[model samples]
Target: MLQLCRDASGAPLAPQGSVVCIGAFDGVHLGHRALLARARERAAALGARTAALSFEPIPREFFARGTPVPRIDDARGKIVQLAAAGADLLLLLRFDAALAAMSPEAFVEQVLVARLGAREVWIGADFRFGHARRGDPVLLRELGARLGFGVEVFPEFLVDGERVRSSGIRAHLAAGDFDAAARLLGRPFMIGGHVVRGQQLGRKLGYPTANFRLGRRTSPVDGIFAVRVHGIGPVPHAAVASLGVRPTVNGTEPLLEAHLFDFDGDLYGRRLDVEFVAKLRDEEKFSDLDAMVRQIDLDAAQARSLLGVPEARPAGACA
Candidate 1:
């Protein structure tokens, strides 16, 4: 069982001591996985539990204020990925004003030492934290020495001689290069959420869709896509998805709507994962409802072709 905890001040979670890995872990990308692996390895050797410490809202997002910060993975995805990475406990601290105001020494003392009872702490080589982002590995090691814990900085995780970065992955997704994004992510780029009820506009347009809200400041990927819908059955279903604010509908919030091909059933409240296979086109505004539906027909046809699904034949037509 993995424990999800917030708040820097709390009853010590690991009285037996723990190996702690700290980062924003926004995407839980390949680089973040390496750090988690190291933490788990060290914890096993020391007979301590593995704890992953990250922040909710991410520090950058919290500081961005009115500006929307693109996220590679949403909040739920981050927690799910972290737990699946073998963390015994997850500390998702709230990145509020109080947490941001804490000094480096105080953070180490309160969160790492007093709260988690960290025996060994791990972080990425360039990781920084605390007030004004002044804390570095050097400062952490010095604090560890006085606080009776060991500190180790994992070497920069790289791919093909270049460092892996969340920002880089975001760029790939933004440009609709899912192959490049997945190469660094170690898995297909996906967004998962419980299906939510929408305005039923798609159904009225002759394509009912399962809608998933992108519950973040902004989504890294947008536009129409050739995709697969997973977690509904034994095999993933081919689908066409749209991600963006519905400009034609006068909407202002980002939403992901996936219409599974040749399928019909209720998906409300069921969690599903939409995996991007290819970028079909960018979202566009149409002159009228009929025009919008016309483009959707094209999008669905293109998506089906990309996904290797045969197009639906006219009723009673030759095979």
Candidate 2:
């Protein structure tokens, strides 16, 4: 389990011997993994707890007022992924204007040195912090020497002969290249949300679906995809998902509608983690209901095949 802490008075909570990694850690992608692995190794050698310090709303989102910015995952999902990466403590800092106004020295003295009691700090090569983004790895190294702490900066990580980064991943996902994005992330790109009630038009079309309203404004891709729905159990169910505003229905907000293959049960209010396996097709507005139904059938077959779900099963067995 990871503990969340908030401090603004420059008061130390943990003992003065923690190993900390500071960043946005939005996607927890391969680049983040490299930094975290180094932090874990250093923490073990120094006999200190490993902590990841991150911020909510990200600075860009906070400043942009929910403009057209791409987010790989929400804050909650990021915490869950970071916790799974072997962090002992997860610090979610509030990124309001007050906190953002702190100088580089104050940030180090108050947040890193005082509140977390950080004995060692790990960050990426391009890491920067404090008011107007004045802090840098070089500055941190100098400060660490005077503050009686150590600083380690990891080089940029590469994937597919390109520098791996959150922005690159977002670009690939936006272009509907899930496989390339997955290679950079070391896992499938996933969207999680609660199943909400829709217009039930799909049910009328003979293809009942569960609709999900994303918690974040930015989604990676807007298309139909073959996906795996988790949070149901260990075995991920095969499904076909549509992510976009329904032009045919004249809907306004972007939505995700997933039709589970060979499954029957009410999923209303149940939170689902939908992992994109492959892009089936870009979202399109069909001329008629019959055309849409035909395309959905094709999508279902492709999704099942892509997920490796057996075409035939034993009698009375779920597909």
Candidate 3:
């Protein structure tokens, strides 16, 4: 069973000692999978369980702008992906002021030695931690030697002769290169969240949508797109969606408004995973609702063609 631990002060993740890895793990991309594999391998060799220690609110999110942090994956997706990659436990520590205030020694003593009982810690070549980002792999290794555990710094990951970076993937997504983004991720870039009620503006404009909000979280792209919606029932569904603040509607927050083709029934509060297929256009404001409606009609048509699915226009669409 995989454990999801939120409080760092809780019982030690693995009392028998653990092999552990830590990172932002924003995308759990190909590179992150490699890191996790190494942790799992070391765990197996030592006959110990594995733990993945990551921060909630991601350090970037906490320190950067409040909205649209340009993230590749959300929290729940990271946890699920990490577990599937063989982590026995996930420590999603809250990144609050106290955590940010802790010195390098304190972080290792409290979280690594106390909370996780880590027999060995593994991280990438550029990993850093502690208050004011003062700790690096060198510091960790030195501390580990004196503290009785060991530290290993893995080489930077490479894909196609280039290093894989979450920022690079975000840049690809922002540029509307879904293929390039997916190449870095080892899978299509997607966001997963439970459906939340929206203003129903899409419905009034002839497209009913199931909405998800990034909510002070970061998103890499903002535009109309062709997409696939998974975790709806069983099979994935082709869809047209807009991911951004609804400018034409005078919206302010980042929201994902997905219009699943030919579907009906309540989706509110149900988990929806949206896979980006292709970008249609940038988000822009229309002078009037009628103009916005016409553009949406075109967007829906383009999406249907891109997805190779016939238009499933909801009943009562404007002529």
* lDDT (C-alpha, whole model) for all candidates: 0.91, 0.85, 0.88
Residue ranges of candidate 1 with Cα displaced over 4 Å:
none
Residue range 145-235, candidate 1, lDDT tens digits: 9999999878878887767889999999999999989988889999988999999999999999999987754888899999999999999
Better of 1 and 3 by lDDT: 1
Q: Model 3, stretches more than 4 Å misplaced?
A: 65-68, 311-319
TM-score, prediction 1: 0.96
Alpha carbon lDDT of residue 57, candidate 2?
69
lDDT of 2 by residue, 60-169 (tens): 88888758677898887898889888887877888899988989999998888887888999888888898999999989999999998999887878886889889889
Query: Top model by lDDT, which number?
Result: 1
Ranking by lDDT, best first?
A: 1, 3, 2
Model 3, 245: alpha-carbon shift in Å?
A: 1.8
**TM-score for each of the candidates:** 0.96, 0.90, 0.92
The global Cα lDDT (0 to 1) of model 1 is 0.91
Candidate 3 per-residue C-alpha lDDT over 209-235 given as tens digits, one digit per residue, 9 for 90 to 100:
999988655788889999999997778
